[model samples]
Structures are given as structure tokens and as C-alpha cells.
Target chain A: MKLLQQTILEKGTVLPNGVLKVNTFLNHQIDTGLMIEIGKEFAERFTDSNINKVITIESSGIAPSFFAAHTLDVPLIFARKKKSLTLKDNVYTSQVFSFTKQETSEITVAKEFLAENDRVLIIDDFLANGQAAQGLIDVVKQAGASVAGIGIVIEKTFQPGRQILEDKGYRVESLARVQSLQDGQITFLQEQISVTN
Target chain B: MKLLQQTILEKGTVLPNGVLKVNTFLNHQIDTGLMIEIGKEFAERFTDSNINKVITIESSGIAPSFFAAHTLDVPLIFARKKKSLTLKDNVYTSQVFSFTKQETSEITVAKEFLAENDRVLIIDDFLANGQAAQGLIDVVKQAGASVAGIGIVIEKTFQPGRQILEDKGYRVESLARVQSLQDGQITFLQEQISVTN
Candidate 1:
């Protein structure tokens, strides 16, 4: 987490409307070395949870989740945002609102991929309002699976993303937490363990 | 490649309207072990090309591409389909038509991440009409980057995707080539190498 915090300070850019762009490393243009480290961190943190699968939304979250899934030696399922031709008709779907994109879309996972006995660890690149993670958790709920926890690369603590999931009694962990983004300067907050609390 | 062929034959579903679903292990629900192998294969195939970066589109391509990037010890960049707030304004953009979704959208990669001197290897989940890969190649060209080759997990040989790229003099490689998918049966064609030739 210290290395991630340092990387955010070095490469991250703060945009207007409380948007922090780590596209240079985390989301868009990824550093595979850093990605592996992030994945190892998540795997090390959640190794004791008996996670059978790592669930994430499409686009940004797939990379880190893939690394974590690789480390955990489990399957990683990315909920598709678009209703593609290849996606099956029998899917568990949940509507998600993206505060960044300012549009609501449905995220879906095939019912057969997620089973009732599976313990899923949700992963994402950023958690602002927590709508995306909530949608993934909803899909897991529909499949009757257990929510092991949530792993986030970056979290905007100024928003209520982490609080929303914690209120639901879900274990949420983020590598980088931005307490505030003001005047092109970013502030960091110490990570807290919600599961033990 | 044999393992991939066997996976498609066993787990893939032939959807209505020529849609072959391999999401059980390839895209939606990803098998991390198989993904690592796919990445290793791509790395081995493109090792002599001097690829500095691996380029892909969002959602599906990021996972395999990430592993490929890791294996190659280079960076991986995924083009964004939608313009988001966090993405920089300065980007190399191209339009891509999705036959599965029946729509066209613009894809963009940050200009700083892709350089004119960089040799890129394009990676994608499917090579169906090759429109997505073409769009990526266009973005790379816009940045003045050289494309070493294209790596695809599943290519529909019956479709015009691979031919379009091959006719354009691009080295395109696919792990599993489906000759036909009809009546709930899938026929696979052996992979052909264009890099050596």
C-alpha cells in the first residue's frame, strides 16, 4: 500500500469534479509489474477467506482482478456491461450507476459461472460511490454465493463508496485512499480493516 | 493450442446467429491458469518481434494481454471505448464497429503511453471481423507506432476478420480457429504461423 501511495503521488493526476486519473499506471496504461504487486497484496490480504472466485466489472477492474485471481489460483469473473451476442440469455444482472460516466448500465454474470457454494472476492480499480461494486455484489447475491470481501486499487474517501459497503457488513479493502483532492493536491488516508471491526 | 481446442469443444456454446460462446473460461469467467498459458504462448510467439508494449481493448482483452505483458516484462495499454472524465483529452482515437453489439464507437488511447518508436503487439479476445483489432492498429498508426503482430484467443475462420488483417500485410495469430459453428457443434482449424513466413 505504501508503494501504491507513492505511485499515486508520482504519476496520478487530479482532474476536476473530484476525479483522480491514474491512467498512466493503474487503469488505462498499466504497469504489469505494479499490477502484479497489487494483485499479490490483495491475495495476501484475502488468502484466508477461502475465495473460490474473484468478481469484477468489465474495463478497468479486470487487470488487477486477473492478477489477484492468478495469485489466488481461482477463476475471475468479469460482469459484462454490454449485452453482447456471445453472452448467454440466462444471466444474473444488476443495474449500476457510474458517477464518473454519469450513466446507469446493467452489469451481468452468467448464472452458471457463479454457484451457490462459491465465495467471491470482488475487485475493482476505483470505488467512488460504490455503485459498481454494489452491482457486482448484487449479481453474487442473485447467484446465492457468499461475498468474501471487496478489493479496491483506489478509493475516493471523500465520497461514501467504502462506507456504503461497510454498512452492509462487507469487508472492503483499498490499496490507495484519497482523502481529498483540492487545488491539484491529493491527500491520503490510512487504511482500516473493516472485517475485523 | 490443443488445450484451447479442447476447451472450446467442451465448454463453448453455439449461440443463435453464429455466436460462439467461450466465456465459460476465456472472457466472462476467466480461468487464471489457462490465461497464464495463453499469455506465455503469445510471449513465446512474439519474442523475436521486439515488442515493447502490448495493446488491447477494454473488457475482455485486458486479462490475457496483462499476462502477456507480464511475461514479456513490458507495459500493456487498453484503448477506452467511451470518453471518461479521468481520461486525458490528448489521445489517438479511432472508430470501431462491433458486429456483436451492432454499433460503432470511438476507441481512444492516451497519446503519451504510445510512442512512435514503440513496437506494439495487439492482443484481443476474439478476432471475428477483425474490426476491433483494425481499430487498435489504426490507433497505433495514428501514434506512429509499429505493430509487430496481433494475438487472438479465438478467431472465427469462417468470418472475414483474419483475412482483412492478413490481406493488409499484418501478422495475425490466433490460438483456436473455429472453422464452423452450427447445430451446437464446433469445428476447429489448426493455427497457422505468419510471423516466421
Candidate 2:
């Protein structure tokens, strides 16, 4: 978590409309070594949970999800933004509004991939408005899968995303929570939770 | 490579139009252990090349790219599918036509991540028409980076992807090249080159 926080401080950029650009290392381009460390951190945090699979959305969430899945020795499933021709007709889907893209898109996962017996963990790069995470949770519910927990790389704690998930009674863990990014200066929440009870 | 070929034969479903869906292990739902093996294989394949960075597109390519980067001890740079508010104005962009989606979209990489001095290896999930690889190659070229090679997990040799890259004089090494996928039977090319070589 410290490595991720340090990377964000060293490389993340702040833009207008509460957008944090981590393209240099987090999302667009990735530091694989650091990613493995981050994934190990998530696995350590959520090791006690009953997470059988790691779920994420397309584009940004793949790397961390891979790392976490590898660490936990579980399968990684991602909901695709654009449902390709290869997808089956029987799918659990939810429409999500992207504040960044300003467009509504459907995210889907095959019904066969998720089942009532499965425990799922949602993972993502950024947690801003929580719309994307909500969509993934909705898909899991549709498949009758249990929501074990949610893992995020960088979270805008100032936003309502944390509160929304907490309101739903889902345990959320983020590596680096940004307290404020006012005046182009980034701030972090220094509270660290011990993985063990 | 045997493991990958076996996965394709077992989980991969053949669609109507030469499309083989291996989302269960390769793309949508990933098998982490297999991916790690794939990463190790890629590392061994490109060990002799002076690859400074591993470049790929977002979403599907991120998992293998991360593993490959980790194994090879290089930075992984992925091209984002869209322009976000946080990305800088300076970018290397290219258009890729998705055969599965039947549409063309632009993929962009931040200019700073790639440089003239970098030697890149482009990695991807599938190489059908080679549009996605071409897009990534274009971005690398825009950055004046030398492309050491192109690595594909599964290449449909029946398609034009291999020919196109070969025409470009790019060293392409596909772990599993499908010679045919007729009547739900998957066939692999001669293992002499990839296996014995």
C-alpha cells in the first residue's frame, strides 16, 4: 500500500473535474513490479474473506485484478463495456453512467461464469462516483453471487463512493485514499488498518 | 504452450465466423496460473531481445502484458481506448478495427511513457486481422521506439494476421497458432519451430 501511495504521489496528475491521471504508471501504462506488490496487498487484506473470484470492468482494472487473482490463486472475471459477438445470450448485465465519458454503457458477464455458490470481489483502478463498482455489484447480484468485498487502487475519499458502498454493507479496502486534491496538491488518508484482527 | 493449447481446445468455443472464444481462461475470465505460465513463456521467447518495455492495449492485453513485464523485468505500457480528462494533450494515437465489434476505435498512449530510445514488444490476446497490433505498433513508431517483436497468445494463422506482420518484417512468435477450427476441432501449427527451436 505504501508503494502504491508513493507511486501515486510521484506520478499521478490532477486535472479539472476531480480527475486523477495515473496514466504514467497506474492505468494506461503500468509498473508490473509495483502492480504485483499492490495485488499482494489486496490479497493480504481480503484473505480472510470468502472470495472465489475477482470481478472488474474492462480497460483499466485488468492488471491489478490479474495480480490479485494470481496472489489469491483464483479466477479473474471482467465485465466488458462492449458486449462482443462471442458473448452468450444468457448474461447478467447492468447499465452504468460514466461521468468521465458522459455516456451510459452496459456492462455484462455471462451467467455461466457466476453462480449462486460463488463469492466475488470487485476490483478497479479508480473509485470516483462509484457508478462502475455499483454496476459490477449489480451484475453479481443478478447471478446470485455473494459480494465478498471490494478492492481499489486509488480512491477519492472526498467523493461519496466510500459512503455509498458502506451504505450497502460491502467491506471496501483501498490502497491509497485521497483526502483532497485542492489547488493541484494531493493529500492522503494516513490511517492504516492492520490485516489481522 | 501445451497448457495454452489444451485450454483453447477444452474451453474455447467456436463461433459462426472463424471466431474462437477463449474468454474462460484467456480474456474475460482469466486463469491466473495459466497466465503466469504464459508470462514465463513470453519471457523465455523474448529473452534475447533488448526489450525496454512491454506495450499493449488496455482491457484484455493488460493481464498477459503484466505477467510478461514482470517476468522480463520491464515496464508495461498500455494504450488507453479513449481520451480522458486527466490524460495530457500530447499523445500517440492510432485507429484499430475490432472484428468482433465490427467497428473501429482509436487507441492512445501518453507520449511520455514511450521514447525514441525504448525497445518495445507488443503483446495481445488474439491476433486475427492484426488491427490491434498494428495500432499499438503505430503508437510505438510515433514515439520513435523500436519494436523488438510482437507476441500473441493465440494467433489464427488461417487469418491474415501472421502474413501482415511478417510482411512488416516484425518478428512474431505466437504460442499457439490455430491452423484450423472447423467442426469444433482445433488444430495447431507445426510445433517444431516454437517447441524445438
Which candidate has the highest lDDT of all? 1
Per-candidate DockQ vs. reference: 0.79, 0.80
What's the i-RMS of each model? Answer: 1.2, 1.3
Q: What is the lDDT of residue A94 in candidate 2?
A: 97
TM-score of each: 0.93, 0.95
lDDT of 2 at B149: 97
> lDDT per residue, candidate 2, A76-172, as tens digits?
9989987778886888889999888789999989888999988998999888889999999999999888999999998989889989999999999
Chain A TM-score (model 2): 0.95
Residue pairs in clash, model 1: none
- Give the alpha-carbon lDDT of every model: 0.89, 0.87
Distance from true location, Cα of A116 in model 1, Å: 1.8
Model 1, A9-88: lDDT tens digits are 99998877667878888889998888889999999999999999999988888877777998899988899997777665
Measured on C-alpha atoms, candidate 2 has an lDDT of 0.87
Candidate 1 structure quality by residue, lDDT tens digits, B13-104: 88777788778888888988888899999999999999999999997888778779988999999999987776657888999998888999
Clash totals, every prediction = 0, 0
What's candidate 2's i-RMS value?
1.3
